[model samples]
Target: MRWLFPALALMVSTAAFAGADTLFVGGFQNAALARGGSNFLWYRVDRVPPDAADPVQSCIDARDPYGILANYHRAGVRNTVRTQLRAMRDAGQQRIATGIVHLRAPAGQSVDGRYGGTLIDSTGGTLHPRIRDNLVAFLRDVYRAGFSELLFRYFPQGDNTPVWWTTFDESLFQENWQLIRSIEPILQASGLSYRTDLGVEGMPRAWFVEALGQYYIDDNRPDNPAWSEYARRIWRNYVAEFDYRRSVGFSFVSDSDPVRTRARVRHLRYIYMLADGSVRYPPLFAIDIYGGGTTDERTIFERHHHAMADLGRNEPWIVAESYFNDAVAAAGLSSAMATTGRQVRYFLQWPLDRGIDDCGVNVAPPNAYEAWLRRGF
Candidate 1:
């Protein structure tokens, strides 16, 4: 599924008042973060940057300045992203895309703690002071790095790939959600105590915990069905607790592979069901279009585009994470640039073509993207 945090419930409200069926306004809910309308940008720095300035900035500059993506695996990445964001602001880019990413415990590092004799984690050794400091420090970096939202996707892959979870079942699902809930209080308290505007909010996961819980039902385990159903019931409760407008959900085009497509389709259906039949209630959906992994780029793009024709049926959609893959390898740099331009056209046109409240597209390859932006594609 998709993932992070920039929103939570019982906090200040920023959602706009719109009709229930409509998903976007002028292609976005928040104009400031969306930059100049609904636009997408690159997600550079999969890991930590060696320095603050990105050497590839010249290559990846695009007009889609709504937001940038990041991960918290490496501590140095925060510095690099902050530097880039400030530079963008200095360059007169008023929108100043708020960098977004996740902050989770590293692999195999079981962090446990006790709250003044109240045990925090199953593991007994990790104390409250240690947990508070580490969690606070990591979250504080989110404010320093200029990230607008955070998604606590401890398990990165949407449909339960389970990097952090030792097992892929109900037990892990329960533990992870509990941990996320616990971390929220710490995040809030730390932000206040330190006097940092870390107003960091939560992002509804695309499918993370809920999906894994669903798997237990698929596995045909007795009693686990009730457990999984109960998980969904509770998730519905929590999502209701947190205002739905502040959350965003992730989606994608169905692949030619029937297996993945079936899984995604099922997940999509569940997301809708989770909304309790309210079109306006589910987290806003972002359509992911990373082209050409196992087939022609255009073919992939078209299928995804066509598949999502009814995506608007469930909820409003955005070209959440899209880019012309293999651009550098096809023809030459200029040809790739031209191809990128065409892809950009298709994404932008879809919203106009369908006449739905298309949220926006976030395309990458900043190296060639700036040129397309100049051409007004």
Candidate 2:
């Protein structure tokens, strides 16, 4: 009974029922606030060292001594996170969602492998013990921070080297599932509701079917032999596993490449409908509109929003990530917090006008903490 309603379901219901509501948005920084002209913020807890003549020393210096001490010493990072959560609560926001990357590196690790335990090892691999005790410590900190909702990024394909989709293997999938199970107790204890990002590439049918017992198919790829079988199994599994009243959903990533984008969109729509001809999942689609440095700002927003509206007619949609340097560079677009703010505002307003609800902002580092607070306010 306690697991009856996932946090995201509650959010969707609230948004759908509420009319003329202002979406409190936050992202990597004030961009969310600026673009949407809404009050919201998302904080980033991870530390990246500043640049210096000696990159290693600079990286070491960049580590937040207060954050580290707060985690390693004192009540630990969780306590420090609580302090930040309190700040947001004091600002009068009833709901707060925290974002944390589950990462691992040996003690005293630096970038460039000059020092051991860098983000990626010599073999161009992410740190092992990917989900470690420190992550538990961080989650405890998140709970202490007074957050009841969280957006967990299992593997951020964009920032991580080689990308998750490119290197995804059976071992990685198993590791991720193990981590999820291990943290379930903590999540339940903290009363935290979570949403995870499935990378844009969309997972293989076998991986999802084997891991979660359900696989999301890209509507764009309807003809793929794998999708038909996957769809069949999903229907059978859904009836056996989930309560119909509870909302089930998945995310989709749009690529800049026309061919890839079409394929993704087609596959996503196909999966949106179930064998019974009912909308099996909430239409909470996500697109990577960051442009990767090549898309025009207006064009990127317009195309992605229009695409989502076309596919997500009766359901809500969210941007999994936004305004990354690579996206901008790939699209040949130039944007700042102002541009980001405007786009978010447009997205929020569009849905409200159409009588639909629910949207989310992705928050990352540097000014993430500040952005988190701003959104709540």
Candidate 3:
């Protein structure tokens, strides 16, 4: 029987000896690509960069990560997917964790070309059929293009390869759920893969719950029967759509925020109960603590630690993304973990990412944090 924390087993077992117990550490661009052990880096699978610098090989030269968290968005074209995949193989990157950053069109926006537009039907109540067809075609192309060994957010049974999976830079809006509902079954049916990183963003806090429509149900706040019941209905739909496959799990990514952390943990517990104990994979919570150096990450992180414990479950977590170039923020994050008895399963650094020029938040080159990060790590 598959047990809970299959991904956690891979992470915790390897990291236990490190004393810090971080399973994977990595982030947006070249900074994370240089670190050893499991690391994450973003790529625009739709096109190859024209740059002369080869960061992937440099990372392998330092040490092969247990796996690479290859983050991408759903808008990528298939030809670019083939091009990028070939490039990665040529570069000698074997273990890969493929994640879609934003699965659906951002609220009020739409995607161009083959992947189609919004997933919602005209009534705004269900998934559009074309979304599933497009997704299936895209994934089949990916599977055919020499990506047989895959890693999802939840570790699948009989697959021992360890890869860290997490969502980045997007919140879990209702549309995201609709997209998952449409895509997950196709993955399972074709046996291409299972388990997608349920994107949970911390910056949105109350907006996250309110937008997710789970406020009274799993927010750990005072209950309102009507609201709680509505939340339960939503959870029921999630369970029905997911069908207890052990294929879906959580991977949080955002700048640190205590309220969001508390609500997500409690929310997971409620989900487990609603599944009638069918949900087995432990939802791994990770944070992408980003700032321009003014945010008090330490205090926020400390609150996050306590909030997890206060809810009655405490598991080793991941510092999935951070601007580790800032010495003060880095030190504060480390100290908070030590003081709170919370062990890190991974610590990834986010430096200026030159690979994807479209990224709004990428830090430009000559970053002082790069020098500081290299010296500090």
List clash counts for every candidate, in order.
22, 47, 7
Report the lDDT tens digits of candidate 3 across residue range 1-377: 01222322344111112322212334312122122111222232122244526533333222211111221224444455556555544433322334332232334543321112111221232334544454455456556654332333322211111112222212222443454565566667654533344432311222234555443324534233332333333445665666443332344444344555665555555444454655343433455555443456677677777766887657665554455245665666656765776755434444333233122223211123332243222
Best by lDDT: 3
lDDT of 1 at 302: 43
- What are the per-model C-alpha RMSD values against the true structure? 13.2, 12.8, 13.6
lDDT, model 3: 0.39
Evaluated at residue 70, the lDDT of candidate 3 is 21
Instruction: Give the C-alpha lDDT of model 2.
Output: 0.34
TM-score, prediction 2: 0.48
**Cα lDDT of all candidates, in order?**
0.31, 0.34, 0.39
Candidate 2 on 1-377: residue-level lDDT in tens? 00111221222211231223334444433232112111112222233334346543333333323222113223443444556556644543333322222222234564332222212221233223432344455556655655433444333222221122333343334433344344434444544544433222232222111236544434544444443334334333434443322222333443554444444444544554565766455424434343333644346555544544565443433444333112222222223323433233111111011111111222222222222233321
- Compute the lDDT for candidate 1: 0.31
User: How do all models score by TM-score?
Assistant: 0.44, 0.48, 0.47
